[model samples]
Target: MATTALGEYLSARRAQVTPELIGLPTHGVRRVPGLRREEVAMAAGVSVDYYIRLEQGRERNPSAQVLDALSQVLRLDDDAHLHLFRLAGLLPVPVRPAAPEQVDPQLLRLLEMWPDNPAIVLGRAFDILAGNAPAYALFDGFQQGPNLMAKIFLDPDARSFYPDWDEVARYTVAGFRLQQGRSPDDPRIRQVIEELSQASPDFVALWDKHEARGTRMTSKRFHHPEVGELTLQINAFDVRSAPGQELVVYHAEPDTPSATALARLRATATVESPQADQDPGQPASSRSSWSGSPR
Candidate 1:
């Protein structure tokens, strides 16, 4: 998906709403299903030619007033409105080298001691900052390198690991889009976006949707090579005082086959520190032998 501006987003949204929804009269023999460009221009108090130019990417910049008008005319919600403003360059620029939040020592201790729990700590940009032994063993294949986003987007094994590959891909791209919107100026994020855009067309399509999401609760179904299939209840908790840092932990439902698999994995567990496994600067809680990189 191509990076879009406010004009393009507004125009696309307008084209999706029906005439009746917006109280517009459809004249006889209408060619387009939704409101026409002329109708949107009239509603937005702009010229049809200008609206066309905006939609075609000929005009990239838009003022706050115009964005407000367009937002009102398009009936966009607060999040959508903010997205439009950011894309238009009407909002204040995002801070550079975003301030890292402090991680709670308690949270850190929990992750360190949970030897059998497949838990991982992630940074705002989806960096696998840390994980316990089980997490390392479960996702070791994707952590061979330091980058998690790159592994999922570039590796083929990811499809086999995730039983619902399509849903996983969509969620991953959506997460990336949310990050891109929040930190548009981050050089690392830009490079990741460019790489994924080139690597996966599916990612490109989902990225274009401008979906915004943060690390939160989600259930995942994994087809582990060793464990077969495991359905887990995943909970993501923000580490208090740690801005942009989240702890994502996976738990198997009680008395189920997945629970049994979890128990078996625990029985075969081996403890390894992130520093011992990898190099300096990476957290040990996230290290695993599958890919052999420092957490």
Candidate 2:
């Protein structure tokens, strides 16, 4: 029988949960890495045959109660739980083709106003749609490109730029998985996934984990070539004006060493000025360029 997406997800998640994690005894040598099929079914309050059917692609539709119980037994977090529902067709998935991402003029202006904060707009596929001067300075080590996944995974500089490279890579992969779940048919997302899977073994490993999460309010540490070490708090917001666009802002706490470093970096950074003939309403990508050495 052909494997269903829901079945694949359930199987992967189940394998990650060991019997000991859920208070099940290991009476003998176990062949499976996680709980046995019967164990999961009994723990989730479902029959062995029913749970087997669900994992075998014989049962496509599971009620909310069944999914919820299975989710609990699988020890899935909120993001992973939502991903399970999506895989089971319980949540709505976007079917429309993703439109070309364009940052709103108002949003661009807002980014420019915050010279102290590093802000950038990212497309659904993690493309760097637009960024302010400080933002460019912060990411000066990265190659000038649209897609961030390529820069993070393909570019060697990323490893050093982000001191906690392993953690960042895992977080990024999980967030990308969440985005892919929402827009499964998106060609760009598929392209990135395929390209990275072939190029980066690290990316492939994280992708197979099937973790789903989005960028949240968190602090990140960076090793800037010019500014040395700096820690910044990240805040991600959905751009209501443009669907599938996210505005990410990074700020350092006032009076802290990181804040001082950020201020110093922003002051010395030499950002390219917009051309006089260029239309102001055009997306920031066209107006500003990321070139030359880090200033």
List pairs with backbone clashes in candidate 2: none
lDDT top scorer: 2
lDDT of candidate 2 at residue 175, scale 0 to 100: 88
Alpha-carbon lDDT, every model:
0.67, 0.80
Which ranges of candidate 2 are over 4 A from the true structure?
215-217, 271-278, 284-295
- Residue-wise lDDT of candidate 1 within 139-203, one digit each (tens)? 65564265567666667777787778777777766666656666777776776778778887877
- Which stretches of candidate 1 lie above 4 Å from their native place? 1-4, 11-36, 39-81, 89-93, 98-107, 215-217, 239-242, 275-295
- For model 2 the local lDDT of residue 112 reads 78
Over the full model, what C-alpha lDDT does candidate 1 score relative to the true structure? 0.67
